[model samples]
Target chain A: MKAALRNPVDFSQFPDANGHFDRYGGRFVAETLMEALHELNEAWRDCRNDPEFLAELDADLAHYVGRPSPLYYAERWSRQLGGARIYLKREDLNHTGAHKINNTVGQALLAKRMGKTRLIAETGAGQHGVASATVAARLGMECVVYMGAEDIQRQALNVYRMRLLGATVQPVTSGSRTLKDALNEALRDWVANVDNTFYMIGTVAGPHPYPLMVREFQAVIGREAREQMLSEYNVLPDALVACVGGGSNAIGLFHPFLNDSEVAIYGVEAAGSGIDTGRHAATLCAGQPGVLHGNRTYLLNDEHGQITETHSVSAGLDYPGVGPEHAWLKDIGRAQYVAITDDEALQGFHDLTRAEGIIPALESSHALAYVTKLAPTMRPDQSIVVNLSGRGDKDIYTVAALEGIQL
Target chain B: MNRITHRFQELRRAGRKVLIPYITAGDPHPELTVPMLHALVAAGADIIELGVPFSDPMADGPVIQKACERALAQGMTPRRVLELVREFRQIDAQTPLVLMGYLNPIERMGHAAFVAAARDAGVDGVLTVDLPPEEAAEPIELMSAAGIAPIFLVAPTSSVERIRRTAQLAQGYLYYVSLKGVTGSAALNVAEVAEKLATIRACTDLPLGVGFGIKDPPTAAAVARIADAVVVGSALVAKMHELADDPERMRREVAAQLAAMRQAMDQAGMPTAFAG
Candidate 1:
């Protein structure tokens, strides 16, 4: 893979004109709630510069969510995949068992700072719901989560965890009874309660400030990995890889390294069956440009502009669209988007579990699947850092059922 | 004849149920779209609703979404769909054709350009999903100038004031969304739709068409009893998907479904002369 196109925009300028990421992101929300989003953006901009805010977040991450998770060298997996040396950033070991808590905690603290009393969120695989609930309890705020009716059934245990954490989980039955429906319901709720409530969006998706904010909180992953690789290998990795479902984890691991001209950023999408089968969630690799969830991004929509169904082995990555930032990154050649089929992801899953003793979430398995392709071509001295976004505990049952291996 | 007004008056005078079959213009295959329109008319379609595939249809269900996907995968475009309509006009000039879709494609094509192109293509009306009657004044004026009826939707959740406003702005038949959810959702309350239709009747004299849940012949026939027209979408779209590999089979099955609805509605009353 070649080097990524340099991102011309500087982070120091913060919230570029029209709130865009090089003409990709902006406030494309409903008119009734523009003031609310604007207020949020202003508050976030102030907080980013405040040392007190950053210090509080750093303390919470250290004592509450357990930051500085280990960087594991997957020696066995590297040999098996015949790839360049593979290193895993252990975000999956973070509190709440996924990278979602990283953003949720940061946003919850911001919500408290903004004097908001209630917090609301939308979840797809229930990971974000659990993370939000966990943080709301810690912050002593009222939390409400909207989930698709279908996801509620599929992830019943996480739904129970959310309830146990003193959060209200509302099931959305609109649209396809999936993530998009939950998002629509959450948006309706946000519009209705914009004055008193804070919407803690789970991923680097949504209208504007959200994608940028979530990415900022997640940038820690890349910063730590870059520093660790420099100390351990005495050189920059040839490539950075992460799974892209709404692109939170990917953006987290990609942003800090955007200025690194020598590093290649690869966003691996979940191709449930295959791209040709029309059942995959590889939006940028196979889809066209369209507006979805208030963002002008690439979506798997039909000619009539109706959103199509998407499938993936990982419930978390099964959405039909990717984040708008990812779309823009691909357009500018800042990143290369590829897809890993369900079978290949499964192979990656089993290989990681057996070789590295790390049972990765199906979502993270997408990145592992990409390494299997990129490793054999690289020189032995080259390095690839994979953001292990989440653990496999929540996905064990799903993977077992697919493999006909009863737990 | 002013086909739209004449058709509405004819259905009014006869007290017969109108059969409006919706088909995406380039669905399954673009080359087969015009022939499918002719086949549908031959199988007893009174009005043809040609869906112009846009990139986003917020109100449609999964079945119609898939149909749009197949058409788009085959490289179907709005211009290609209009070309199909122009070809359909060559054989059946009198049957009313309505281009149903969202505002973006029309906006992207430019409202003035769309009206001009549609008028030239022999289109009689349009039903843009997102364009409320409140925001429809300018586009309605543009369409009306081209002699194209600007059809509008009246939902059951709509307040009486909104319904009255919608009725006043709507040109052809009023489209009454049969349920509270998007297109293809289950749980249709025909009684609720009928009551809403009656409320709308107090505001305007236009014919009302009930859609969004008319899936089968029985449901279509039931809706036809109270409303002037029944719009069947998901059932027909599902048929297209089931037969996407075979265009001839898709056309036959779709035409058969429309013919079944037509036959069921025909039993309610007989055709009468055009009152206009």
Candidate 2:
């Protein structure tokens, strides 16, 4: 039925004035960061609307980060499944080999316009760290990235890439020694040095303007996908699928299609081991509403409200908290959240590489894993577009270690 | 009246500056926390800030962060904290105990339930580090209704507008983060704090307590000369950590430090600008 366009509620008006999407998202930092957040919010507002500022961003997106990544139809994979036709939104093709560079470039431009000379970021898989380092190097700004000590070991390749790009990678030894710890350290750095540093958050999380700002920057993904679908394929896909760690890439794709009633949105979270085993990063799938890392969102916490340690084969999807928008989307039934176990995700990783000659990032493999199940449930006439958020080159070590193959 | 307000008023009438010492609940050992509180009161704490250990304390430096780790390792939760407060109330009911921590644990405990439980446990005030005044309306209302004061923090980066807004919502007292960084950070500048307090004083008449980097007694005395209260946290917590294997020594040493600050603050009296 063509009845999808009847309701047409505007999804762009989110985060109200207070940076809240209904009950989620708010300024939940120390007072030291309140004014800094307010300043960043105002600057983001001005830069997002200013023609010259946007022009610079667009030029950089074109010449520097390589935007408008191809939308490829997965013919062989779809026919083999004997279900819905599948397409891949190739964010993996972007510079730095991931979708993370899109938001980093935009935030870097804003930081330059705001006269900030230092950039600080936190990373899990180190893609965002590398992306932040790349932009800071290009803009002649000093960059420092906080990474978990464990991740510094797991993602040594990206860590070396970041250092090679002239960014200092500070190892965080606090908390669970992963992405969440890295973020806490980064926030501490921001609080201590709020005067001159711009915190370039890589995901659609954090305080007020960040979830909104990162979403807008990443919306270029959905915008391009929408245009390509209309101009090339003549219709929107029946559903959209993307991995949700902090829900950056997923929200980027889902935000543009929120008003499109017929398009089903599925946010895939990493269920390390399995949800029933009480070890997973499937926040929206298993968590309750709570605040952490500067914003209120769905978080994996114990009965005492302490954030639980999460396990995931994919480092990027190992966060205890998902973005507030994803929480709101799940609560409002705008998007369906599902989880893929490590074994299933590994299978999806191998399946994509063997069938499509594309070794998807372990993070993106979670989405492809969901697509493998959901595509077969739909008709052959239907279509699905999965965001291949990053390439798997960074995950080669992890995959090889798992397969017991020496490099 | 709330115990916090009453205590501050009594201190003001006595021409004595308030000394608030913070210690993480369940640190070193959960059994030692109540005894520690008593020792602090005997030493000269007009009000006490009990630190609720959170797994992730973003606003704390290495000192308090490690303190929280030790406490949480001993199985400290919001409920356990209230139980500790209840036990402390059993012996000492005069000293106003303020529960200080991040907001997630309380949010998990539910605002209404946490407030009521806190009130019943004899807690006088609550200072959630991450919850600023703008997002504090619900908690403020709940805490006020429960006769517990909702404390707020004012930072060096806080503008006049934010100070005014926070002043309106703050109950009992205002916690002025004396420096721009987290707790246990280096070097407290008294001149800078005094200048910022003057700006904050114009916004509200709430009692202003200076924290973050008030290390030794001399620094405490310097802060006491300008602020209504002096809150010593990291230095005291660090001392507790050093003597964790021996609870009695830890309590005695912590008491000595607080006693020294109390003596220095008494000698310094109150700030002339804020003197009645």
Candidate 3:
């Protein structure tokens, strides 16, 4: 029985003309990038509804990026939880092994239409860098990825993979020498080369258009899941869950279901040591409202306006800020955010691999770990959909190191 | 007229380019900041940009990053930076001082509170690196009510329409980033900077002070040729980093660097007045 009786929530009302959602998300970039952002906003507004542009985007998404990834019902894993049925949205099955390509492909096409000859991005775990590099290669455009020197050392395989894909992996060695530093460096590069280069931001973070734009691109996950759920199960799931690093994957899975009043959504943040210990990247759960990386969202900072260092077993989930829309959602109580420790995520990594023969990315494992707790509490007839954001091949080294065994 | 406009006007009447030197408050040590301000004035700095030490300075290079780190470690807060300004105002009320940094510190303190505190501390202007014009309404209004000139940055990549918007929104002189990169970057292309300044000048009568690559005396002189003011930051901040263990040498060396640039700018001020 699909009990659906509620007032509909309008989707178009949010992120007003200035790109703000009530109080969150705005064009908070340097002045040099204002015109470029305005141009991008105009181009996106024009292309979003244009039939020809939509045709091109849809064609690329289907033929090139492999859209409408399967929604697999994890029967064995669902039985193990013993409370609710579980379905995994297989974003890992997409080309480049993650949901990140969905956005990189969309933005690269926009970049092409805008006459941009090069694509540049910043990546922490190298997932986005690879995705951006893959799209740039497909578009016959030059690509450069700014990665922190530390991340390059940590994610050596991904660095090699990016280089093999014909992208220049520039190492940034400033500040804490991680994703934030790489992001700063990438912004510098974009400002310097705004004439020829397009900054294909990997997440639903950054300034105004990016948070809105990336969510629109990645919303394919939720849109497909919505149709698949109705066609296969005859009902929308009781809940949707995904990990929230910069909240790209989570936002993608949650956006389409936003107006569906009964479908609950949850965002799991990485609690490295613990939220109480202040070492985690759970910005929404533990942070205050402040500005960083172009938007005023939740931030992990000290008494002064300095960004604080964050820790996580998964490099992809270690950023200090979450997406601005997520902040708005959290504040308005549309979504609930919880933190899962590194050990808990690691347990999730082993459990899914052993039970369902799925090697989920450490980032996706965070989402799985949350569902592990949440699913067991729900009724047996109820079900939940968790976005399996990526594969775990990138985490072999970090997982091995956790057990004191070098990979 | 505001202190910033009046100072620029005074410099214009004297046929000399304005020299603005920047130092992170509480960098090296908090106690030395007041003396550093006085020394900068003595070294011919027409205006001073007191960096409100922030933890994450994205637009800055290594030099300002370390300076912010040291200042933060020493427990420098926005209020402390304001206190330092109050102290500087005690000795010298003539030279204008601008508070500069990312917006988090100010946002942490309410915008109205920060503006009021700045006004009370005799801060004539402010330059928030990350506060773009589109998102600057409330802060601009607060600053305007407090008679604090809200400074804005105009990068080389800024379009003419963008500059016009900045000109309408901005209260003080525009801070022109000479190059596309962060502070302490390589030397800028003079012709390119001159071309951008011309586009900017067409938008407003506001004075433009160029920084972010003017590291040495010649570069300062070169930028001073095409702009009304020459602003230097990372070069002097780098000196403070090198002399962290020795406060006397830090002050002396930083002052010497500013003095050289000031002398160079003053010498090159009249010949090339915003012209090719």
Candidate 4:
């Protein structure tokens, strides 16, 4: 059943000229980075319309990055839930085993066109670090990744992988010694090296151009999913679900479908202990609007506006601030956001592995966890699509240690 | 006139350069901040930058970052920083005070509320590190209405167009980041900074204050030769950290360090008029 409806909100008009999404996103960086951001905005605008640039980006995505990943029907898992048919958007099958590569590949291309010889990024769970290193290696550009010291110790395998890919993994020991700290360190590095360096931000956050640019690069996911649903299944999914930290993957899947008024959108956040316990990374769920990093967004800060520490079993979801679009989306009532506890997410991970023989990343497991709750509330005739954003190969050691097995 | 403008005018008339020293508010100890500020004023600091410690200071290097952490750990908040300002104003009303930090704390307090409170606390100017002139229309308007000057940073990478734009909105003095990095970064190249200052001078008549990497007497002296003011930060902050155990020594030593820079800058004479 197709519904022909005109969307009240036009998605493209967002960030309106100055990169603001209804007062959520703006360039909040220092003056040192202003002209550089302006230049990046200009370059992105130019390349966005250039056929040659599109051709090159398309060629690389098709051949090197492997786009148009398949949409898989999780029949067994859907039957087990017993309420709605479930489909998984297989972003985990892409190169680098996650949705992170989609943005890094595009940004690396843009950096190359801008005549940048170096790429710098900040990573939490190391997926983006690996993706950034992979693109930098392919493009023959020097790469540096700022990772929190705590994360570097936990995700040592990805640290080695990035080093093997010829990227320097700089450990940040400031602030909470986590993703937020890494972002601060990365911004410092960018400020110091703005001339020859391009900051390849890993998410749909930061100041202008970055959130908009990263969203545009990632929108390929929703575009493909929409076309695939119409052509193969003949009906759009009743619900869309994805995990959000800085929200690149979730935004990628949600953007194309935003104009579809009938579609229900859900963004899941990581609730380490619980929301009431104050140890969660659920920024939109439990945060006030404040400025941080480079934009005005909902942030987990105290009464005095100091960024608070966040905890999550999954490193990627442990952030105090979310992408500004998510904050805007939540405020506008266009999308719904919920939280999944670590225990529940772990259960979802095991349930998906056992039921469908799919080893999902812990970050993606949050989305799957929500689907287990939402799918059971809907009719079995309708379908729900959850973005399996990455594979769990990197999490084997973590799961093993939790299960009392030495990997 | 606003105290900042008055101070700059007074210095200009005196053919002397302004020496601005920055210290994190409530650093070392909350009780010692007012004393430290008084000591700085006694040391010939024409204007002072009082740092409101935010947990994340992206524009600052490790030295100031640690200072912020220390301050935050001691329960320093934006309101408390204002209270400190009020205390400092009680004794020394003439030495203009500028609260410098990132924007979140002020944003936490509504812009109007923050501006009104700042005006009440006798804050002469505000320099939000991450806030440029482009996204600052509302705050700039609010601060201007409250009779408080809105200070802005002009970086080495700032374009001529940007300089003109910032110069239009800015009051008090424009803080010129002497290098291409965060506060307390590498040494500044004087010729490079001088050339940039000339470009900036072409845009407006706002008095210029140079900061970032003006570590000691010699560097401050070098900067005083080319700019209207020499603003020193990390050197004093690092000095404070060294004497954190002794608040009396911390105040005296930090003041002595600033006094040395002031002496050196005074010996350098008034900066040669911008060649623009």
Candidate 5:
């Protein structure tokens, strides 16, 4: 038997012909909306390579969403951990208070460029809903956000925020009444309104163009962090860390650093309870490779091959499956994946709020927990950069309620 | 026995209700799969449905998807699952084995190649969950050439026209999904199922296998009273997940469950055990 030769392009050229990222990402959508996705793919391909489009996006990121969010050197926390000097990329400082706004702004602009008049989005924790609504408000485009009924109750403030921004929030009461259900409802909605509605997905999970497109939009975090670190520290940070739910934040922090052989990337998944307890959201750490929600990726499931309910303190990170690109990254050994329990994240959340006076989102606290672990073992000269993906205002009340502490 | 047909005929003649337990290969760990299969057979499973894990299993609820994830994580593949069947044939040649999965993986492996491989692997039947009977011609013909029964699913939502179409190509027995939603969902409404079974029975004399939401011995027994086979998947798969690390314990628990169901079915008025 003859061996087939392998392709030589890097991860950027991936999802080749068949929509596979090393047999991971592919179109697993219904037949009805394949044409819309294909059209989106064609538009994205043309727009991504256009200098004018790139320039416009760059300007939007810089002036609109406030890109190049500062790299704050955490000296006190660094000294307390005793591992290495730690720098935080303040994506949480962005206009919408999270990295989600970056992708939503870019996507909304692209939708306008493609002549889309209306926008639809599916949200789990409602961060993306708020971000999408912000973009729609800015662009004067009609917006509808589909969120699971369960999520609407848990994140009522975000739902209110979306409505305040002129976007209609539709609560989906199907299936588990969570992210997956909202996604299914959104897909159905897209199929029904495929002609004019631009479905703006929240993360890098879904089918082909989504994982690639969202990653590209979020990649700005890593690109800016790398340049900033090089200019300030005169070297690439020893390790780059971020939380992985649907993996958009982690992929954003890791994508630009992928070509840097010397830089190590770490993705911290939420271990709601613990991996052994079978109640965690550590898809890459504890899950198996499978297909769900349009992409082949690591998923937490059971013996009959069914997807199980995932647990995490952060509503944003509570999912059973992860982006296929994360699977490809794990396969290629470009990224190291780890998990932090809810307790650890909560502790980190408290530590950051007290020490830095920065309330970090519960999802971003997972990365902070990793930093707490990584800092203790690093050399004094080595620096670690953590992508602080979002602010913690939305999570403070929930965390305080869990701890039985009043603000 | 002439394999599936003969097994069904023998079951009918003996007035026995068949017990089918589903298990995803390579779950918990890939290496224990063959042993688990042998154990399932020993545990009172009349026929085994080996599920091939696919990424997008839309028909499955959470339990089955989790099982697929575990199996796929252990690097389970169609070829590997077939090898498990072949290895099981070494000790138990009479037990019928069915490969249940979606069509994409088989299509990826090429239909012709898959049929040949499945046959070589000692597979007797194939059930593609998402493929309708109208589009099942190519794969069904290929499997028929290999003497493998191609099982089809009939739902409560299935019109008489759809049932007639599915029955035309369906061999072995008709698999009637008792619920409107995915597998492992709510319990089967026996009355509704009985009506649907009657509708299906009106069309063909081929044995009817009732599955989806038939969880416990009582449900299985109730289903046995009206159907040829009671296919219990989620319940069995749940046991596998619970006993993933201990194959011996899994075998004992699963076998005991099946035996209890078998006994329940026997008491429910089957003429004999293992009847079609």
Candidate 6:
């Protein structure tokens, strides 16, 4: 049976006045950073609408980042599913080999306009670190990235890549020694250097301006995909699928099509073992709403409000909190969120590699895993677009090691 | 009168500066926490700031962060820390005790409920690390109604407008983060702090308590000479961290450091809260 597609609906104005998407996503930082957030919000509000800023961003997106990343029809994978036709939005072709650069370029430009000379960011998989470093190098600014020591050991290739781009990767050995701890270090750095440094938050999380600002910057993915679908098949995708870590790529792809009631959206989270067994990053699915890293969102925390350690095979998806806007979306029934276990996502990696001859980042495999379940249930005429967020070259070693082969 | 106001008002009448010391409620060892509070008072502390262990303490540096980790390892909760505070109040009733921590635990307990529990726990005040004045209206009002002074931090990076707002909302002494870095990082600069305090002084008549990077007696004395109070945490917590195996030695060593800093402040002609 096919799902009904409703007609187009008007986009609702959210995050009103105070940057809140409903009851979530407000500014909950220290007093010292209140001034800085205000400054960034004002600068972003002015630049987001300005012709000069948008032109520079557009020019850079076209010439520098190689924008309009092709929407490739995964013909072989579609045949293997024997159901809905699947198309891949190739965000992996972007500079830095991931969708992260889309927002970094815009934020680096904003940092320049704000007159900040330094950039700081936190990374778990080092994808965002590489993107941040690339933009910082392009802008000729000093860049420092905080990564958990445990992550630095796993993502050694990206650590080296970030350093090659003239950026410093600081290892955070505190707490769980992962993305959450790295974010704590980054927040501490921002509080101390609030005068001159700009914190380039990688995901659509953090305080007020960051969620809204990063979403707007990365929204180009969905905007381009929407037009390309019309230009190619003359129809909107029946369903859109993307992985949600801190949910930057997912939100980017989902934001533009939010008002299209006909388009069904799904966000896949990395459930390391599984949600019922605990130790998963499926905040929206299993976790409760709480405050972490300056925003009220669904978080994986213990009974005493202590943020619990999260586990995921994909370093990029190993966060305890999801983006606040996703929380609002979940509550308002605009999109659906699901969790895919490590074994399922690993199967996704293998299937995509063999079928489409395209290796996806482990983070992207979660989305692919969901599509396997989703695609088989739909008709051949129905189509689905999956945001292939990044390439899997970084995960080759991890895959080999998991098979007991030393690379 | 409330303990914080009474302590400050008594200091003003006596023409003396205030000296406060900070220690994590469960650091080194959970059982030793209330004992250390008593020892700090015995070492001439006019007020105390008890740190509530949080999972992610963004404002703290390495030492204090490690301290929180050790505290959490011993299974410290807001309710347990309140029990410890209640036990400490059994022996000492005069020295003002302020609970300092992040906003999550209190948010979990709800604004009205947490404020009421804190007042019942013999807590004199509360300073939530991440709750700025702009977002602190409800908590401030609840604390005020509960008779628990709502404290706030004013950093050197704060604008005059922010300082004014913080001072207006803050009921107890204003915590002046003497340096731009976290609690345990950076070196203290007296001249820069003095300059910033001049701007803060113009904004409010609230007693200013200087903290961050004040590790030694001389630095504590220097800040005491210029500001109304000196609050030291990381250095003292580091000492407790070093003597983790021996709670008595950690207590004695930490108390000794506080005593020496207090003597240095007095030797520099800064009167104690009880002296003129």
Which candidate has the top score in DockQ? 4
Q: Give lDDT per model, in order.
A: 0.82, 0.94, 0.90, 0.93, 0.83, 0.91
Q: Whose lDDT is higher: candidate 5's or candidate 6's? A: 6
lDDT of 2 by residue, B80-120 (tens): 99999999999987899999999999999999999999999
- The clash numbers for all candidates, in the given order, read 6, 0, 2, 0, 24, 0
lDDT of 4 at B36: 93
Over B60-179, each residue of candidate 5 has an lDDT whose tens digit, in order, gives 767887787777777787778888888889998888998888766776577899999999888988887756564457888999999999998887656677678778889988888887
Report RMSD (Å) for each prediction in the order shown. Answer: 9.6, 1.9, 2.7, 2.2, 11.5, 2.9
DockQ of 2: 0.87
Clashing pairs in 3: A306-B55, A306-B56
Of the two candidates 1 and 4, the one with more favorable TM-score, higher being better, is 4
* lDDT per residue as tens, model 1, B1-276: 458778878877877778888887678788888888998899887788988775444466656766765777787777788889899899898899998976645655667988999999999999877565644567899988999999988766566776777778888898887875566778588788778888988888988888887888778877888888888777887787788789888888889888988888776454334322
Cα lDDT tens digits, model 3, A1-407, are 23223523365577887788878888777777877888889999999999999899899889988888999999999999998999999999999999999999999989999999999999999999999999988878999999989899889999999999999999988777888888988888887788888999999999879999999999999999999999998999999999999999999999999888789999999999998888788888899888888888998887666789998888898898889999999998889999999999999999999999999999999999999999999998999999999999999888998899965
Which candidate comes out best when scored by lDDT?
A: 2
| Chain A TM per prediction | 0.96, 0.98, 0.97, 0.98, 0.96, 0.97
Error of 5 at B199 (Å): 35
Which residue pairs overlap in candidate 1's backbone?
A: A83-A375, A304-B54, A305-B54, A305-B55, A305-B56, A305-B57
> Cα miss at A148, model 1 (Å)?
1.7
Q: How many backbone clashes does candidate 1 have?
A: 6
> What DockQ, on C-alphas, does every prediction get?
0.06, 0.87, 0.62, 0.88, 0.04, 0.68
Q: Kindly provide the TM-score obtained by chain B of candidate 1 when compared with the true chain B.
A: 0.94
**A118-230 per-residue lDDT for model 5 (tens digits):** 99998988899999999999989999998989888888789899999999999976456777767766775675567788999989998778999999999999889999998
The C-alpha stretches of model 5 lying farther than 4 A from their native spots are A1-9, B1-276
lDDT of 6 by residue, B1-276 (tens): 789999988976876678899999898888899889999999989999999999999889999999999999999988888999999999998999999999888877778888888888899999888887777889989999988989999887788988998899999889998877788877789999999999999999999999989989998878877898999999999999899899888889899999999988776644465345
Scored against the true structure, residue A140 in model 3 reaches a CA lDDT of 83
Expressed as tens digits, the lDDT of each residue in A108-183 for candidate 6 is 9999999999999999999999999999999899999999999999999999999999999999999999999999
Sort all candidates by DockQ, best to worst.
Answer: 4, 2, 6, 3, 1, 5
TM-score of 5: 0.65
TM-score head-to-head 4 vs 5, winner = 4
